[model samples]
Target: MKRILIILVLVLICTQIKAQRPMDWAFKLNLKDYNVKYSLPKGFSHLDSMISSYCRSDWSELFQYSLINTEGDIAIRFLMIPITPKTAEQLEYRKRLFNLSELFPPNQNYLRTIYFQLEADTTNRIAYYPKAYAKKTFNVDVAGEYDRECKIVYKGKFYKSKVVFLHKEDRMDCFIHYFYEEGKEEKVRETIAKTRGMFRLR
Candidate 1:
């Protein structure tokens, strides 16, 4: 009887410990336009506070949130831009700038160099959400998705990174960028999918 009682107490203690552990993901930030929640992979940390300070110094208008892992190999950024007619026109113009063929005219060398510097791949395309979700959540016809493996020069070191872009245009435009170490591309993609799956728009 004493042995059984001890076993039950151990089981109860284990269950309580597990319940008290933090979730893999949680609500992280609240902004004027929307709220954001995020999760980092096993060895990562959220860097919103540090990144926010740098963003406010220069990109305060568009910067929303940012995250980075402890190893400094992965990062994510969220930006929200209000959609006015003028801004919509500018967005369209910037989209065209991604066309390599159209980039052959004025300052071709500079433009092409900048393009290759980012190593933008040819995978840009329209990303469609579920009809119900599009209508209800973002009210957008479609989102723009692009991903690539690129090289980033940071602090005098070159890092090969996989970058993913998710842009949604509605009453406001939402952009998300996910950057991870190149060799972990598949894992990063899975993480992004899971994050989006649980993403909240309030």
Candidate 2:
């Protein structure tokens, strides 16, 4: 009887660990002849209405994917812009300019010029990181490819963003991880970490 009870407890603990492990999904971001593969966390569903509402022509050109949680709040956004058909000199120029600093809009009027134009306003107040938080920077490694990262606060919520230019693919991919009303920062962090670990640029 004692041995059976020990085995049952061990099995229960193992099951809980497996349940907490992050799950991954692989997909493609394609534009004409350009295509890249990435592995990201699951449980997010596509928010089709965002494409029709928030997205405009210029925005649509670069917006590859928009996803949201059950509450209808966007949790992840994947943006890509192709830089092919350019001369070798142009590629080098863009690569130099494409970094974490360039990912965000100008701080002077970030909301009015960029966020408002793209996402607009939906009862959400715009809040930029103060000078201290603005200096916070991090890094992301996706299947060995590295990128500079930063955090931004929107509507009193936190988000992490990564921007990188793929030299081989000649494209720029911007990844934004949004923390919505879930109120679970640890879960969001784990998801971001897991997805970043599994990302593969093809």
Candidate 3:
């Protein structure tokens, strides 16, 4: 019985070790892993502030951008910006999605914001995450939920995602959205796990 228990413990440890993705990065290879020490790009504070204030939720601990390196001569940057709008006017201004079925034309990512509807005061509020998802097509991969309301997208070989939490408690009554990488089903599961823990639908 002692030997059997010991073997079981060993198996558990081995499984846990394999489950965690390694902390790794390479020169000009930003997607190797996630690094959060860096400050966000300029021109993003107002948007971030608006999101936090509108939702009345703290977003400093929310998902940050993961830099990815590329072989292309032109500069390519990639990161997920989570955001929400406080007012209807603000929400309308953030609609930045344009179609990119063509790549040879070299489409730059539309720096867009996905809004979440929530109840605040007598007025309804929309919140958003602020970060741009930009990158070269070959270097990174992106998948998003483009619907009537919520839009979610993640980029690159490593698993990094952006999401908006929608609940049926009060004001809004429509879309619920979550985004992830196209082929990265495993990573998407991990993202959902983290999402459920840190976010609230209501």
Please, what are the lDDT tens digits per residue for candidate 3 over residues 1-202? 9999999999998875554323112212332222212233222211111111111142222332222222211111222322223433334344433343422111111112232222222122333322222112111122223222112222223222333322221122112233333454464455434433221211
- Tell me how candidate 2 scores on lDDT: 0.39
Lowest lDDT block of 10, candidate 1? 51-60
Each model's C-alpha lDDT? 0.45, 0.39, 0.28
Best by lDDT: 1
Q: Could you give the candidate ranking by TM-score, starting with the highest?
A: 1, 2, 3
Point out where model 2 deviates above 4 Å: 1-32, 49-62, 70-74, 87-169, 197-199
> By summed lDDT, which 10 consecutive residues of candidate 2 come out lowest?
138-147
lDDT of 1 by residue, 142-188 (tens): 44345533333322332433333323344344555566654777866
* Top candidate, metric TM-score: 1
Q: Relative to the unseen true structure, what is the C-alpha lDDT of residue 166 in candidate 2, on a scale of 0 to 100?
A: 22
TM-score of each: 0.46, 0.38, 0.23
Decreasing lDDT order of the candidates: 1, 2, 3
